[model samples]
Target chain A: MIRTLPCSAAYTNGFRLYMVLFYIFLIMPLVTICILAFNDSNYIALPWNGFSLDWFFANTNERLGLFKDEGLMLSVWTSLETGFFVALFSTIIGTIAALLFEEEQFRMKGFLYFLALAPLVIPGVVLGISILLSSTYAGTYLEENLGMSFEFLGPSFWLVVIGQFSFGATYVMLLVGARLKKFDRVLEEAALSLRATRLEVIWLITIPFLRPAIIGAFIVAFLISFSNFNTTIFLVGSDPTLPVDLYSRIKFSSTPVLNAVSFMIVVFISFAAMISYVINRKKT
Target chain B: MKKNKSSTFFLLMVPVLLWLVLLIVIPHLDMFFRSFRFENDEGLMVFSLNNYLSFFEDKIYWLTFVKTALYSIGVTILAFIVTFPVAFFLTKVVAKKYSSFMVLLLLIPIWIGELVTIYGWMILLSDNGVINNFLMQIGLIDSPIVMLYTNFSMTIGLLYMSMLFMIIPMMSALESLDDSLIEAASDLGASKWTIFRQIIIPYTTPGIASGGIIVFMLVIGDYVAPNILGGKSSLWFTEQIYNKFLATFNWNEGAAFGFLLLLLSSGIIWLALKLTGQKLEKVGS
Candidate 1:
């Protein structure tokens, strides 16, 4: 559309310059961080001494590399573990939600749909704290009245998973629901008319058709759960997830190890993205 | 078959009902109720307006609240302005084959997460950081500029993290736009600015609204960028809520602040939707 616009040479040049600067602004900082991961300096930033792999490999007194940093490693593990469970739960629940919403005669569909998507609008901090507050209240009430302690209600591993999952499922629902909308109901009706059970039809036909979206939603939910901070911080206990751990460290003091971690994440995400992009292109 | 249909409906309903009731409904209602109660001298919980009242009475609280809203709105506008042209260029100016690749580049930062991006900005903006070091090497200045821990840096952090969201929606909107409309208008002697204002803007309003809402909500609720990048005086309202909950252990006040944040942000979004004549359902989708 812009190609059709009647514009002066100056206007075209100005737009080109603006785009150059915009891409620079977008890519420069990330490139800088990755470069600094190999910096020999003690600081996270530059004044580049010669390159060294100390951040990634060293385990000396002062230079503790990310590989050897037990605390950070544990946090990363916690995040992966949490991401797995959150993704699992959110995919199951959210797929069910997508299927439920697709039902033509469902009761109060509009209201229920809104309820499902409500987590998206609510701020993460608000969600985290509200869940934290209510769970604590429930925990205290139960302990006082029924003499049963619910450790999961308090800030703990499971609470963090639950907190992240609250919003994660919403995303999954939207993703899967979009794909579900394009599904041909005629195929299902044909299978049903031939005396196939509803369960068998859903399993053999519907699930297979929705496979791409289900896989995509699962990966997306995992990524969201892993990188989430605002909500996770409030619900995390002594065992902090990677983002929470990174937050406290960045706030108080930071080292080049952080750059190492960032560099690895960049590589991982870019690899995953390219693979998906290739797969998607092939599908088309 | 009738029993199977009912059972299937019930089977699906169980998980959705459990999730909505346990996670969404009860928690928020409990927080709302907690916000209204306070402990008296007898250490017993009683109803009071103290939490909400204190928000008005306290200068810093209400001031921070207003500042957060204004800054978030400013960032949203800035994000839109900065990304619109990029979106336009990608969708229209650039060749179709390469534009998708360009968009993939855009998605990398978003997938890399906020902490990594914030850390990247810190490396750029900090004293003795890359920019300053390069400047000093060229004999530009004697002293390093105090760019980090300032409102400028904080705003940059916020904008950098969120601008991609704006571009994506705008691109999708612009993608669906018919090119001949613009060509016809131009051929009919419509000025470029007039064509843009009359044709492009009206067509892309839905995308702009959705993107604006997202960026606004993100900036307003953001804790990492403000705390990590902003100076002491650049206290965001989320920080106030954080202090109330974790720092001071004042859950009631924190809950009140939380609700206020939710209400104010939602109210602003609602007004924007009203003014734009977009429905919540459509914008939300």
Candidate 2:
């Protein structure tokens, strides 16, 4: 569909130039940070003093690398732990929601679907606050009324997972639901006609068909939880997630090592995204 | 058999519905009421509209609230303008094979995370940042200019941070458009500008509306870009809510502000949707 319109060559040239400049505008910052990660300078800023991996592996006073930094590493551990749990729970619950919507006779489907997506539009800060307040209120009520105490809701690790899952699940639902919409109903019916149980039909035919979307949803949920700061900051207990830790650290005492961490994360996520892209392309 | 099917359906829906009701809806309802309740000077709980009143009475709070709203709206429009052409070029101008790769370039920044992306912007726009340094090296300026911590920097950060949200929707909208319509218009001897305004713009209204909603909401809700990129001068509404909750420990006030922020963003989005004749259900999808 190349344009056969009476467009001038100058217009095409200008459009190409604009595209190149826009790409630079979009990418220059990340590229700069990546390049600066290896800078040998003590400052986080410029004057790139030759490429050095000191920021990543250096273990000494004033310049401990990301891996060696105890607090930072702990935050990284907590984030990974939270991300895993969040992804697992969100995928299971979200997949169920998608499947539920697939039923033609499902009651209140429209309203329930909207309710499912409510969290997606809510601000992360508000979501975090509401969840924290409600959980703490519930925790106190249990302690006073039921004479039992629960530590899980009071700025604990599980709170972070729950807070993240509240919204992350919506993402999973959308992804799986989108895939489910295009699925053929005949396969499920054919399997059922062959005396396959509902569970068996879903296990063999439906699950296999939805594998790519389910896996993709899991990865997306994991990444969202991993990088989420706006919501997670409030829900985080004494152990901050990687983004929270990086945020506070960047605010007070930023080092080149943070850039290194960013570089590594970018690489990891880019790899994940590329794999998903390939999978999706292959599916079609 | 019908009963069994309904039961299975119920079983499948119960967990997700319970999750949404217990975690999402109930908490929000609880917070909405909590916002109306304030603690008195005697340290006793009292229900009043004082928290919301205080938001209106305080000049800084109300002014900052308005400014944040304007900035968010401004960013949304700016982002739409900046990315519309790019999206059009990618979806319509570029060869189909190369467009996906072009879009992939946009995803890299997003994958890098907001904090890291803002950090990149900080390095690029700070006093001794790459931009200033480059300018100095070229003898364009005598010394570094303070680009960071300004409203300009904040807008740039917000625009860059949420560019993908705007781009993805617009690209999808534009891609779904029938190229034959454009060909027909051109063959009818209509100019490119006229075809774009009359044919293309009307078609992508829903996409534009959805993009505006996402970008405005995300920008207004964002704390990282404003805190880091806008620096000390930044008085983002989210930061105010944060301070009320964390620093002041005024949960009631924080809750009120939180709800206010939520309502303000949602109200604007609702109005925009109404004006554009788009539906909420369509916007979310």
Candidate 3:
């Protein structure tokens, strides 16, 4: 519709130029990193000295590929573990919250809805720090008064999971809630009238209808937890997630192995995103 | 039946209540209280305003706070300026079939996460990075320009990671706009600039406001870009909080700084909302 709007030739040409440059600005850095991942140079930067697969497959005293890097591999495993738990918990809880919000008879609906969405507005760093402080306080109090050590409350794997879940669930709620809004309630009523129990109605009918959103929300939650840095950095203890590990390594000294890590992440996430995109398109 | 309904409601409410109270509400409230107290020399915690007072007494803390707030606002505005046209082009100019593909391209970088993108920028902006190498090869400059670990690189990094947030919302808003309105305005003898300023701007205010709020919050709270891409001179407020927590091990001071940051960023966002006449709930959704 807007393509037909009458405009000067200069205006059209200028807009085209801007669009081209904007995309370049957006995509160039990513492409640069992906290209430099195979560079045979010792440094992570440019002036590439011929191409090699050293970053990915080679392992020696000087150049260690991603496959053989123990610390990097452990962090990757830790991230995957954290992402899985965070995604699972957030999807279940967020789906329930979505259902609750959809209930017309729910009390304090507006205020409760606001509270549910509050995590989205809060800054990640603030959330991370506040959780850290409160959990430390709680841990100290428990150990002092009750002689019980709550290791989960401190900076540990579970702490990272909880911290990420704090906001991860909000995302799932929003995603699932949007889908729930478009649902046909008449189908639920029909199943209920046909003598199906409420539990069975939800399980057999509603869950199937919401399957796409639930899957999408789970993936989104996993990605959120996997890539999280600000919040996870505070809550991560001895073992760090991939992002935290990458951050420390990059901050101290960056090798192309880091580029190898980024290359793998880009490939994995892009594949996941494409699969989800295809699923969504097919459903719609 | 009534009992079943209430029980189901109760069941659903339990997790939501636990999550909000245990994770969101209580932690923030605890941090709020912790911000007001300090540990004295006797190894005892006491109620005092020293935590808050120290922020005022220390020039670097407040200065960094101000700088972070200002830079975030600047970046937010820059994001809007840089992405608004792209959003407009995608929604209005591009063929419908290709627009989603373009959006997918945009989402790819964002999904790749900030750390990777920052690493990408580091590769592009470093002294011997791609940009410098190209410039030197082209004989544009005799020596490599120190783009990394500076304010320029930091802003570019911040803008790169966050511009998508601005674009996504604006695209949604622009997608809903009727092309007939613009056509009518143009037919009514309105100049291109006038139509854009009067018609298009007013129509997309909500998107602009929401995107601005998000971009501002993200840029201000960002620690990675500033710490890595920014030089020693470019000290962000989040870094101050991180230093208090990890470096000095002052949870009290860190808590105080954390609250101040929350208050400062939220206050700015609130003010921006009020000025733009956008409600928190409306923009948040």
Candidate 4:
């Protein structure tokens, strides 16, 4: 019956308590690991094992030098490279796909739209395995027909990038399509009436209008690609992505070093989120 | 009026058609064809239901399917329990200024990737981890409780990852409701609980349904959470499928497993749509 606070101060107190509890449950794990990154103990236990920066600087096998470890660093860099490439490929292709969807005359528009989103709906693990199989088969076919062996095409970096795109592009299309759904045709008409070319109008008007959504789609696709474990798992070659590395380590024997990496990720991602939020706030 | 516009439409439609053909439709056809084509002793060749037959005959395959389905439902319910109050408080109860902070706080969990969240939980649940030491300090127990790798740990990880997915849709739905209805109910001398049951709950029914469906679909399709948090002891279907295709060199059986997953995922999507959706009926004035 309460539209307002119901003049109940105790109710507000209880509500605040409940909200605090939810926040605690939601955030405690994240905060704890982050805090413990500075703990001096090799173990992940509590009771405060004396605070130090060694977790960040520790060069041991199982502690904080995960940041310094060459193999792990290479994997991190590989994932970053893959993420950038995937985001670049997917966002451009996907934005074009969104533009295409706005065209009214496509006979199979309904079916095509569903098909574009199918990758997203499929499990990442399934998509990964399927791409690997299909790509390997195609690679073999090409090798026989052309008399050229394409090692990279079979199961490699560019393949991982393209494999991720087989679906990652769909997400970009969906996000951009959402904003484009409310697109006013009148603006394009007005630009045309002003003697603006289609390209000019697109660059000046449509691009500006779609900027926020485009940025959002790009960032999301990047995050998803970088953090992706399922699809990347099958396509992973000698050089693994960060998630693949983390998954392998987690599978065999996890050390506190993985915790250090997670701690760094928390810091970096939160900083990025905060910056985006501020920029968005200022824009509005 | 739109005669020449068809040309514009054609020009625009080319890219999406090409994308669908090259990426999605072709691979799906490949998957279907590969399902029937069992890898023989002679190498990759023609078609049969031998792969599918093997899928049904194996107890391990069937058991994994059951476990995955059960985990999906469990995570959905747990997410529902965890997300409702936070969303409800944000939309209906909290002060306007403070609710923004609360919403932003929820973003912290989501902003960190699911892998990070799982690892974070792992540290806390480790034998010598946070909880164990805290318990020992409080004189609660002598031995550290080994909590990770259990089904309970896996469920917690899934719930954490999926809670935001549930919250966002539900909040959107709840925010769309007219506040005046609750006010009207209050004016009629209704209690807060009664008003909630009669008005707010019914109004947001679609929201809850859609939110639950969204969570259910995502949870079922997920293999990551279980893999990272489930430890080696648990045998999840996607893990098995991954091993078959990548590690074991059995592409045919893997395709069969993939097809089965595709079937189950699609069926869940259909059921969700059926339950939460209704075609708009022409209402009489």
Candidate 5:
């Protein structure tokens, strides 16, 4: 018989045990938060009271649940709105950029590509500050020189979208670009040779080829914009995204409702992830 | 036809080029200019190096900057050591079908909101937190150990935050290795350690480099874990930048510090690339 490998049965069993423990360490925190969310204890920690939904549904003078908390709900609404606008704008511009980069010959293409990728490498905090300062300066110039003012131009809802879209677009471009790399350009040329106009070829062949990537990029961008905190924190004006609101609430005065909100978000994201995993698993 | 194609390319490029210019390039340029100027007594903007000089003059600023860089580097190495085995185990030991499930399990924490993840850690590691309470109930100690607000807690949180970034790349790298190569080495009478060192480590260098770069950059630039878990003991560089901009309203100082951070991170990335001999394009993708 062939010699057994260096790792004995005991060694393999030990390694397997270690892997299980490591996975537990990776998952324990989120599991704890989920459990504590429904705990009847007013405090967020252990010593869980009887199972109750007060954190999710209760509204009283002392304890306000996630559903009844107006400020928290409003922030959630703002985050969804920001995610929508950022996702839409980033998807369009990023897809264009991806298609443009596929062209064989172009001037300054390398430099432009580098610039496009710069946002990915830069720290989000710095990106936020730079965007905020530049927009502030632009707003001042318009007010002083042109005798005009636009409320949307400042640090408001639109600015948050712009700030998030700055990097979100980069992500979309990368995703779409990866997809385009695998595309068969011969299909486009074949369509064009068949008396199909360029626009017709693109609409029929190219866009359909890119549909999966575009949809994937949109969802990815939306999730990123919704969860973004470092960049949006600086750019948010009167209204905060869910993350920023949760951050401030945690910093100052927090309740178990915060845990409830976290629980809801975790469940939603996990469900979305499971769906995407199923879809991708099916495709593969 | 060539001319038409070139013109069409230009038209397609314009929107994205404009977006990058108006938002990214121009804003960074604005920041660069802002970093170099200060308002005078006469309310006139004057170009000076004082903003940069202040960074040099203050011992705390530079010290904290160096400490943050070192701490992040330490975390990067620690994360690599911790995750490499997990990555290896997943790719080498587990069945193929279950590996994806394992990856998805690890990914849940990453895709969850960062703030919520941190809050989870806060509950676990705080003074009267889960671990402490459990330990006390077991008669390990009479009082809760000061787990939170220490450098230990900050590093733990940072490592947790960085787990997925480190693990994903390592898994991908290890997955690409040919199993037969290891089998061949084993058949040649090589010990497992020798095969791992001679073949696996050398082969996965690119993945290691990329993962290391991503993890180091993230840990260094992060403001959340350091602030929430680090408390007063951890003087993270991003916290300094935040204070300068938001607390002091000193945009000039903040801009200078921000550029410095950018420079430090980029410099380290360049060194990593050089040392690993991996192209930016290959590692980035």
Candidate 6:
């Protein structure tokens, strides 16, 4: 919370020093990388040689190599696809969960809210391993007795999405729940009294009102899925997500190209975030 | 109108509630069940305390739990130190014009993935890395410092990864506070430190506790930062759980480890809620 005490100009100036150090510590490394993206040398560190675009443009074949690396590209696509589905599913589901819990007459509201939010508290790594163990156990049981072979029963892309879906949806629930606390039910009642069908009222009235929050929840879920490494690492199929792919590279043979990749990722994400922020701003 | 409304609401809720029960509630029960099954010639399914006991019986396994808790607390404190002042300046101290840009700068790190953040720290903290080379060139040290793959680096990694999580809630809370309260305190003759101690800290305690707890929870359960940055010495409980499921295929032991973390975090949260009664939800508005 803001300090509610009046301070002399000098004391305020003194506090400014800490803010400067915080910025320096947090921002300097990123600036270093941004600058090093233009490095002419093989290394991705300081003492820059002449400024050059060769590292950026001459890396076309390497980019193709990264694509030809089937596992990496596959995982990247899988992550993108998973992120989209998770975002879409979680936004719709979580919003509904939020609205359900927001109403006055729901019984065991606190406990239901707790259940909805518990996955967010649980760690991703633990969640991932738990999902894997349980799924494999079920898969084995089905194969032995039930006379069934199930692709979805093991650690595949589907299981990964399910694992992600469990907690990612919880995040969406909490976010939408928070926003729903202030939702005015009177508007719905007003629309309904005018003889609008329930479906018509929800479609023409409620969805538009909740649009910003639904979008916000989707963006958050998408970001979580895209960048998720801990859970995805264990549950990954023959392919891994982008984070997992990068992890293997860093562990094995790291080139400055990884830095190049990171730089490109920053560009892509920054543009997306800016667009989302602008939309969010306009909405508010 | 009411009858139709209830029906439509139920219709809207069907997929979400069904999904939650099938995926979350059931899987949680499965996690608890997996923790109890024992390993033997029969291959799984014997109720036992051996899984929990093994955490202590095997030094490496439970020790990681202790190490992870300590690491989480350490990183939480470090992040609070870095973020609180920045948030305070943004909310209370800085002029309105500059704070937005500074806040954006603070948020930029978040655009980078957590794994990428770890890599960024790894590059800076490597032996011939950015920070080491910079120090050496100024003749600060004759030899480049060995900074990689240590507990120190692990703390740094967690702090960097956790900063945004800590900052967002804290700033939001701080923004809601009335700036005039601080002016009143000063006008009534309280010193800056006195106002901070008596009013500011008390007002912000919820933010500190919530942000701190969230950071601790995320840090304690993290596997990537330790795996990449802690290289050798970073023994985290989540890693232990990872090994149990994947490496050794000991689901029971891993499940036990997961439950242990759950207990640890739950206990901390219980204490936090115990101390901060109605205080946290008040800060939201």
Question: Which runs in model 5 stand beyond 4 Å of their true positions?
Answer: A1-6, B4-7
For candidate 6, write residues B4-79 as lDDT tens digits: 3467677766776787677767766788887887876777668888888888898887677787877787788888
- The estimated TM-scores of all candidates read 0.97, 0.96, 0.97, 0.92, 0.96, 0.91
Please, what are the lDDT tens digits per residue for candidate 5 over residues A1-284?
01224567777888889898898888778888999999897788877788989988889988898999999999999999999999999999988888887745677888888888877668888898999889988998999999898766677999999999999998898899899999998999999889987667766998799999999999989988988888888888899899989988888887889889999989998998898889889999
Query: Candidate 1: which docking quality band?
Result: medium
Most accurate candidate by lDDT: 1
- What does candidate 4's lDDT look like per residue over B1-285, in tens digits? 355654445555666677678667766677767889875788868678998888779888888988888778777888887788778888877777676666777777776777788888877777777778789989999998778788777888788887787787678778888788778778888887897788877787677666776677667766777776677666678877887876887888888888888788767766765765721110000
Candidate 4 lands at a TM-score of: 0.92
Candidate 1 lDDT over residue span A105-133, tens digit each: 56588998888988867888999999999
What is candidate 3's lDDT per residue for A45-126, written digit by digit as tens?
Answer: 8788999999998889899999989999999999999999999999999999998887546557888888888776688999
Cα distance off (Å), candidate 6, residue B163: 2.2
Once fitted onto the true fold, the runs of candidate 6 whose alpha carbons sit more than 4 angstroms away are A1-10, A37-71, A276-284, B1-5, B41-44, B278-285
DockQ of each model vs. true complex:
0.72, 0.65, 0.72, 0.45, 0.53, 0.48
- Best of the two (4, 5) by lDDT: 5
Q: Which 10-residue window in model 3 chain B sums to the lowest lDDT? A: B1-10
Candidate 3, residue B264: lDDT: 88
The positional error of residue B17 in candidate 2, measured at the CA in angstroms, is: 1.6
Compose the digit string of candidate 5's lDDT tens values, residues B2-91: 755644566677798789999999999989889998888898889989999999999999999999989999999999888888888888
> What are the runs in model 3 whose C-alpha is more than 4 Å off?
A195-197, A277-284, B1-5
- State the TM-score for model 5: 0.96
Give a tens-digit lDDT track for model 2, residues A6-40. Answer: 57888888888989999999888888888998898
Q: Which stretches of model 1 miss by more than 4 angstroms?
A: A4-7, B1-5
Q: iRMS for all predictions?
A: 1.4, 1.7, 1.5, 4.7, 3.0, 3.1
Instruction: Give the C-alpha miss distance for residue B255 in model 3, angstroms.
Output: 0.4
